[model samples]
Target chain A: MRILVLGAAGMVGRRLIDRLLAEGTIAGQAIDVIDAVDVIAAEIPATGRITIDVKASDVSDPDEITALIDKRPDIIFHLAAIVSGEAEADFEKGYRINQAGMSHLLEAIRAKGGNYRPRLVFTSSIAVFGAPFEEPIGDTFLMAPLTSYGTQKAICELLLNDYSRKGFVDGVGIRLPTIVVRPGKPNKAASSFFSGIIREPLAGQEAILPVADDVRHWVASPSAAIGFLMHAATMDTERLGARRCLTMPGLSVTIAEMIEALRMVAGDEVAGRIRREPDAVIEKIVAGWPRDFAADRALQAGFTADPDFASIIKAHIADEKQRVAQAGA
Target chain B: MRILVLGAAGMVGRRLIDRLLAEGTIAGQAIDVIDAVDVIAAEIPATGRITIDVKASDVSDPDEITALIDKRPDIIFHLAAIVSGEAEADFEKGYRINQAGMSHLLEAIRAKGGNYRPRLVFTSSIAVFGAPFEEPIGDTFLMAPLTSYGTQKAICELLLNDYSRKGFVDGVGIRLPTIVVRPGKPNKAASSFFSGIIREPLAGQEAILPVADDVRHWVASPSAAIGFLMHAATMDTERLGARRCLTMPGLSVTIAEMIEALRMVAGDEVAGRIRREPDAVIEKIVAGWPRDFAADRALQAGFTADPDFASIIKAHIADEKQRVAQAGA
Candidate 1:
């Protein structure tokens, strides 16, 4: 199996690469070649059996996208995107990179014009759903994104379905929830605090809680997110029918509940590192997001979420431990 | 009002143009210049008060699209598209014209750049909703179009909402139901039979009924469709918020009910011109279409439907009578 990972420098992309390396195969096929692409140069993992190539490339550039497609990777993991805050603030850059970039990539693949139908696993987001929910958003709720970033993702989902339907590509879009305990520094996404409050505290650092404790949101662990992408790559797409996009299963937890879980997992000292600092802007932005979802379709299709917030914290701790051990070695 | 109507040669576009000429204005502004564009040159209506220019143009061409935007029409009625059957048969042409054409027009408008936010009235379709519907599909149902034509329209709807939200264009997309009692010859559209059964019979000609009489579908009269477009041009869009696409209200009637309405309006002689011909291809296509809709949002926004199928038949007769009178004069 030849695999290509876009946004390979990002946290999920890096972790996914590591997981792929450990498994040495996807869907039981041995890995022959792997291409990792990003705007910034991606790290090429040292491997003896598999050929690994890492390169800096912008998806927005048609030539760059064509170059990636030339390798004809069996599975393409498209995870590159500007975060919510950045997309909202920089309109042109956002649309160019997110919307036009995806379109260009799809067109490039189509231009290849052969029996080559690559499996494209795209990462969509829960941001695709906006506010004023009547109930826990179901699998069939309309996509009326309140933000530019969400709109870009929703549009890409439409493209994915269309391309798949036309036989140009075998596409599966997984609308991932806000990834809990994202193992990285704070990013520009308004929902960044959702991860910061947990990740920062686990590392013995003070993290700001921008919103009220009562405010709830849907989330999944990083491992679960990676799992969704891997499953999407190998799943029986015939079951998907025409609707190629699925909202992945996620745990719905309030800020207070997350803090409680943290306290349970890493004791009172780690949980105490969170500071309640009101950020009206972030609060307003998060207010328009979906709090919960009934992602029955994804669940039926064999996608799973984190068992609970406590387990999510434990998983993050374990990952950090592994990273430390590797660095020491 | 300087008006531009793409696909101005089509039945609805021609009728809309006629309605505009009758009113002498749109949104309370006098009609100064009206440009009608289509793949084939549209017939220029001879009018003393309004300056009308009809021309042949392919919307898929960026230069042609830019040329249309240069006119700076206050309201743009974008109704051009290859019907379902044609789109399905010719894949590349469908995406090029339906999808790329719409995108080019939006980009052209955005490129104008200096406070040029034209009121763009886009004609979407009920095809945006696929089969296996649960009761009446609502305004908030997920768009999972089964056909390439539906996929194109659904994608355009997303683009319309995004562009409107970004303040690039003031766009309102109306998802029209199957137009019944159409005043023209049969076309390749799968739903063409819906109009054919009523239209050909009214003209004292035999019409084929391709599916079972119990098969239900959503429909609206030509006049009602025009009303939706005109209202969309002038309606206060603030009520729409981020979701700009609306499923227009229409009569939900079975084939039996439609025939009954025709008999009631035009007598048994006209209704008897129908022939039962089970076309498997058309039946399969029509089966996947929307049967009914709970268009609460469009209704609340003041878009109305024909009270019943009989009224729709009567409206078609009334329109025919007016056309006859105008020709005689």
Candidate 2:
């Protein structure tokens, strides 16, 4: 079986590629080739067994998307999108990539008519739900995103279902929660602090906490996110019916819980690296975000989340150790 | 105020145009130019006081859409769309007109940067909510359209919210219930029988009832739908906040109730023109439609529905009389 991974340069994409290389199979079928493409090309030497092509490409371009789909990979993991901050700052770019990119990809696949429906696994975001939702938003809650980034994702989710209904593509959209302990420098996303507070302190560096300790948010570890994607790619979609999108199960934790988890895993000194610096702007934005979700459908679908905040922190630490060892090699 | 009406040839569009012409004002501003365009040109003679241009144009064409936007009408009533049956049968056409058309229009409006935001009144549909919803689908119920047309409308609603949020356009999307007793020949839509049963009988013609009498659905009069459009055009959008789309109030009645009302309004002889010809295909299709809605938001926003099924039949009869009078004149 062949696989295509868009946004392969990103953290989740990289880890997914690594996992695929190690497993060498999906849905119990031996893997043959993996075409990994992203806006920023990734560098990876392929194993002699499987053909891997990591290249730079813009998904917003219809022709480029068509060229990519011409390969007819058995499973296509679409993870490319403008980040929330950039999408909000630039409306045109947000729709072009986040909204239109999905359209172009779906159209490209549809153009290859007649029994050529491939499994297209798309990663949506919890941002799709804005304010005014009940605590622990149920599976049937409406999508009233407050941000352009969220709007784009919601629109794509609709298209994914419609296209799949028409038999053009076998699609599954998973709305992912914020990824905790991201191993990267802080970017402009207001929620970036969610990860920075965890990742920075683990590296013996200072981190900023812009929200109150009691403020709650939904999150999952990077490893859990990859598992969700894998399960989405291989799961039986017949159970999904017409509703193709599902909010993946996530750990709902507060800043205090996260810190306590950090202290338990890395000691008091490491937890002390986090400094309080409340920014009203970030706080207001985060307030509108979803705090928790009723992931009964997702859990029933056989997808799992980290057991607790401590498990998420432990997973992040273990992944960090692997990253450091790889860099050293 | 200058007004532009897309899909000016449709039943609701024609009625909307007529109402605008008769009223001679919107938001208490004196009427001015009205550019009426549709895929099929509508013949509407201006009242001599106001300038009216009715022409044939495809909204799917971006250049044509830009040209229309170049006029910069203060209020744009976007009522264009492929009906549910056509959209489902023709997927590409559905996306082109229902999806891309909205995108192009929004993009064109955005291109006219710096204080060029127009009040875009979009006509969405109850089709956005499919089956498996509660008896009365609330305002916040998730949009899980079972049809491609519903999917397209749902996507446009998201775009309307996002674009409005960005201040590119002041938009209001009204999710209209099915317009009952439409003044037209029978069409291929499964729901066409809903209108036919009332319209054909009232016109002293035989009509077919394609489903069981117990089948329930939501519906409103043509006049009520026009009221929705006018209210959407003039209402204070400041109250809309981030959520702009609203489910317009409608009378939820079963087919039996509809026929009983027809009998009361037109006498048993006219109602007796009805023929029971159950269609399994249409029954299956109509079964998935939303049967009711909780229009509390729309009511608070001053949108009203026809009082009852009898009132709806009376309104249809009144409109038919006017049409006959106009044709005779």
Candidate 3:
């Protein structure tokens, strides 16, 4: 088996690549790391083919992806996307890169006809749903996205299901919760604070809480996100069939619980670095998002995540400790 | 009120234009018409400017729509789309026109971010929902589209809702049921037979029945579809708020009932013109579509349709009879 990781330079993309490389094989084959495509240059933990290009650079330029498919990667992880904040702010750039770029990749595979059926694992987000909450949203939720980014993701999910049913590819779209305890410099996603409240405090830096303590959200750690992708790639195809999209399992908690978890993991001194400053824009956008989701189907499919908020904090701490040890800092 | 009709050459589009012209006003204004864009060259029924362009043109080109919107029509009736059969046959064209074309319109509205909130009436379809019947599909049913056409429409619906809520455009997406007794040449839509069986028989011609008599479907008359577009344009924005997409009311009946209605209207001789031809492809596709839907929300919002299937047939016959008399054929 061989694998191709699109957007291999991004945070989740980088971690997913690490997981795949560390595993070394898929479906019993001695897997080869065929390619990694991204705008930013990615460091490979192991020797692998790489093609770094902006997703806009004529992805269908047959030369870009055809050679890799000629080698026929058994699995393709599509993790590329503009974050919600950027997409909502820059409309043209958002649709061009996120929507049109994905279409370009799908069209490339479709051009191959019956020659291949690679497991195409696409990382979608909960942002695909918006505003009115049905309370603990079920597996079967209509994608009424409020943001451009969510709309783009929902569009891609629809395309993935149709192409999969048409036998063009074996596709799976996993709608991940906002990955909490995200180990990185703070980013622009409004939900970034879901991770930052914990991550920054743990790293001995001050972090601002934009919403009220009562504000709730669904979350999964980075490890859980990687696990969801792996499960999506290898799951029983018959169960998914044409409707290839599923919301991944996650723990729902209030911001207060997140802070409590931070205090437990890194002590109150570390938690003291967090500050509260409410902004209406953030509150309004966050209000439209789903606070909790009942991912019963994913759980039934044997996909698991951190069962509680504390576990998520513990996972983040362990991950940060490992990074620190590697850096010798 | 000024109005712009995007697909003014279509059967429904032409009828809508006629209705609006006959009424002489919409929402209390003198009903000034602006332009009509369509694939074929045609005369506009309304005393407005006319613009004809292929539905398959590069609609993303700002120049294509800028001139039309220069007048800033108060209402935009976006009825343009490659029908189900054509879209399924030509996948790339479907995405380009149905998906990209819609984006162009939305982007245009977003670019002009002042008090220019035109009421955008987008024609959606029940095709957005596929199999596993829930009897009457609610407003919150998941968009698990079976075909590429349905997928395109669903994507557009999401974009319309998002853009509208963001105050870019005051949008309303109306999910039209298959129009029965379509008064025109036999089109290639899989569902065309729903109209063809009735219309062709009334015209004293043989009509092929691809599926069995027991095959059930949701349908609306051409007039009802027009009513839906008008109602969507003029409805209370506060009640609709962010959720601007709706499933319009339609009559659900099996092929046998349709034939019965035909027999009542034009006698057994005309009904007997319907030929039985079992087609598995049609059967397979139809199987995944909802046979019945209770659009209670639409009805509650004061939008209505023919109470019975017989009434639907009578309306079609009455309208076509006038058309035939006017033509003096």
Off by more than 4 A, model 2: none
lDDT of 3 at A99: 82
DockQ of each: 0.74, 0.92, 0.68
Per-residue lDDT of A176 in model 3 = 92
- Tell me the number of clashing residue pairs for each predicted model: 0, 0, 2
Q: Could you give candidate 3's per-residue lDDT for residues B1-329 as a string of tens digits? A: 66788888788888887777777778877775546677664465325433222232235456676666666888999888888888888888888788778888887777777899898999988889876657778777789988888998998998898788778899989999888878889876678889889888888899999998998898998888888888888888668766788899889899999899889878989999999999999888788789888787788788898788888889988988899897895
Report the lDDT tens digits of candidate 1 across residue range A1-329: 89999999998999898889888989889998889889998876597788878999998999999999988889999999888878988888888998888888898889888899999999988778776674699988888888788888988998899889989999999999888888879987788899999899888899999899999989999999999999999999999988899999999999999999999988999999999999998888787788888989899999888899999999989999998998899
Comparing 1 with 2 on lDDT, the higher-scoring candidate is 2
Q: How much is A122 displaced in model 3, in angstroms?
A: 1.4
True contacts kept of 2: 0.95
Q: Give the 10-residue window scoring lowest on summed lDDT in candidate 3 chain B.
A: B49-58
DockQ of prediction 3: 0.68
lDDT of 2 at A31: 95
Note the Cα lDDT for every prediction shown: 0.90, 0.92, 0.81
Clashing pairs in 2: none
Candidate 2, residues B19-43, lDDT tens digits: the string is 9989998999998999999999988
